[model samples]
Target: MADIEERRPRNKATTFLLVLAAAAFVVASALRLLGIDGTRHMVATTALVPYFTAAGVLLGAIALLARRWFVGTVTLLVALVLVAAVAPRAFPDARPIGVGQEVRVMAANLLVGKADAEVLVAAVRDHAVDVLALQELSPAMVVDLERAGLDEVLPHRVFLAEPGASGSGIASRYPLTARDLAGPSTLRQAGALVALPGADLEVVSVHPLPPVTPDGPEPWQRDMAGLPRPDLNGPYRVLAGDFNATLDHVGLRRLLNHGYVDAADQVGAGLDPTWPADAVWPPPVVIDHILVDDRCPVDTFQVVDIPGSDHRAIVSQFVVPAR
Candidate 1:
């Protein structure tokens, strides 16, 4: 009888934990369904839905082990629902092997002029990257890149090398024609048309303002909303850069709703984190992206390390779809 009484307290503690886990899952799902991540605090928590879902699953398993069948079953069901919602993005359709015209593309953030020019140039040359998109392109970095033989390798370019994080640029092996698709002054976005042998590609380097504070969320959301949609009827389209928003962000998710497919997500690499490369606490998230139109098939996607930058570069090989 004494042993049974002692077990009651432990069981109650386990049940309490399980209930909290279930509540977390419910709140996350409700926020996601309501599209309420516009605030800084909400956005941060919303971005961690996957982690919270995983926690729910863990708590459920513990409940099961403790023989609390009702709590275990309920929590597991909630976690499974969240998992199902994420599954499509977590494991998208795989690209067919040896199918279309291959084009290697890369996007890197310059950390507001801190990235090494020589290192950036080396990455372009070493990867034999066909198209390169860059954000935070300072005027001095442009000169340094040119001196480091970037022009000799890329040959074609369209750049707006402003002073800070608002700068953006694109360099290509093929001929390029600049386009006026960049939205307002705060967006710092740039676009270009690349002439390939069989098909032309429309590339954009995008950098939306980060939502770090309460006052900044609305502007960041506005900048993301102002990004131009891909002209599906025209040439193949590719948008790549440090977007300052992830798939978890409603703004970016709404942009993807316009029929664009993320290269990393298509290849099951979507969940890999890309920001704050050197951080140990608070974890990392994928704010950088290489989004391709549905017409383009992503062959492979990978993240490349760059020194002195907070973001890891995204490198992807896309198979140009048949016209």
Candidate 2:
């Protein structure tokens, strides 16, 4: 009887310890699902949402094995906290980035759909976007976009040679006398469109490969590093489009390290969430963005939705700061 009593306590202790460890895992799992840990790889991981979802399940299994109530609760809390930090960054900034000049640029991914084109074109006309970058555009769609009445508003333009991959295009209110656009190195389209916009600015619209896997981020990074990165002492520059990763992602973090500021965050109230346009179910992560050099200041930022595509349009109002 005494041996049984002693064994019972020891068994309970072992169970408690196992449960405690499982609880910690549960927390980690929850955090990952809530989209808490924004890493260079997280965007691609969105494709296998089940793997992330399984993390929570595995953690719960551990908690059940151990039966540690307090441990489980704490783990859950920790997981929830991590997600809370990331979830909030998804919105637009309630305040403007700078008080220098006001310019608006709109970027949308038109998934080769007529209805999306129609809706996005209407939004562009309504908002009077000053600068625009579009991705996943077909040759047919490009012709249609140019004909959609933005010609008078955004008369200046830059486009690429379609080497079979979906092309990227740019339109602007400022005059683009000439361009230097290089087509995609791999599957994604990336290029610089030189324009003489009032002064001297080197604006680039890039659509790096969507980070669908580890293989994706690498080539895009290599190509980006090779670009004629803006000169420090000279002109105002901007790189905007569907970069396919969030701010915490490595490539983006590197760009920020190189001094590119997020254009949307500059003039928004954290109200800019652009990718996965199902705002109702909202897998709507902020994959599309506008990033500008320090010389430009942002005035307003908003996300516009396209009818048939998965990404919303990124619209920003900003201009080159006084020298």
Candidate 3:
């Protein structure tokens, strides 16, 4: 009788904990599905939906092993929903091949102008990067990049070089004509038209302000909304840099809805994290991106490490279709 009573309490405790954990998962799943993160905390939490999906699967398995059929079913359904949202990103989608021109684009946040210039220039030369978009650019960093032979390989430039993080620049192997993309934001976003062989491709170095405070998300959301939409009638457009947002963020998904496709997502590298590269806390997240028009077929995508930078470099090759 004594042993039976002890086991009963222990079983109840386990059930209670299981229910609590299941509730958390349910909430997370709901937030992900709704895509209405209005505050900084909620926005940060939504970024971890991929991790929650993994937890949901494990929770479901545990519940089933303990014969808690109701909890097991619920958790499994939540896991399915999360999986359905993120799994396609793991598999490459069928993209049409373009026989016109091959263009390699690379974007890197310089960690407030502190990333290694020599390494970045080497990456450009090694990867044959035709257009390079740089964020967190500074005047000294521009000088450093040139000293490291950036100008030799990518001579054409459009710079909004500042002393601090509010700076952006684009260097291209081909000529760059300044394209106006000014906006009411904190970051110095830049844009230019790349004179390619057959077309003048428009490339924007994007860096939206991050949602850090309670009132910060509003401005961040505004910056996201203000991003230019891809025009099919115009030249091919590629937006690259640290967006301060992720695929799970409704803002980014909304931008993608406007005829833009994330290069990493199209190539099965969507889940790859790009921020907080050298940090131990906050793990890592995918905030840097190379967003191209839907017509441009991505051939290759890579996340590269640059010493002293908090964000990884995203280098991608795209085949721009004949216009």
Scored by lDDT, the top model is 3
Per-model TM-score versus the true fold = 0.90, 0.70, 0.97
Clash totals for all candidate models: 0, 16, 0
Q: Pairing residues by index, what is the TM-score of model 2?
A: 0.70
lDDT score at residue 33, model 3, on the 0-100 scale = 91
Looking at model 3, report the run of 10 residues with the lowest lDDT sum.
179-188
lDDT per prediction? Answer: 0.83, 0.61, 0.90
Rank candidates by TM-score, best first: 3, 1, 2
Error of 2 at 72 (Å): 5.5
Better of 1 and 2 by lDDT: 1
Residue range 103-212, candidate 2, lDDT tens digits: 66788777653435557778877888767777766777766766776676788777653533357777777766344533344444444433443455556666776545
- Candidate 2 has an lDDT of 0.61
Per-residue accuracy of model 3 over 1-323 as CA lDDT, tens digit each: 99999899889999999999999899878877998876788888888888888999999999999989999999999899889988888888888867778999999999889999999999999999999999999999998998999989999999999988899999999999998764566788899999999887999999988887656588888888888888878888898999888898998999899889999999999999998897757958889999998988988899999997999999999998777
**Candidate 1 residue-wise lDDT, 1-323, digit = tens:** 99999998987887787777767667776676577875687777777777777887887788788788887888788778878766666675867553566899999999887888888889888888999999999998899889989999999999988997879999999999998665684757889999888888888898887787647578788878877777867887888998877777788888789868888889888888888888865778888999887767787888888888888998998888666
Candidate 3 TM-score to native: 0.97
Model 3 whole-model lDDT (C-alpha atoms): 0.90
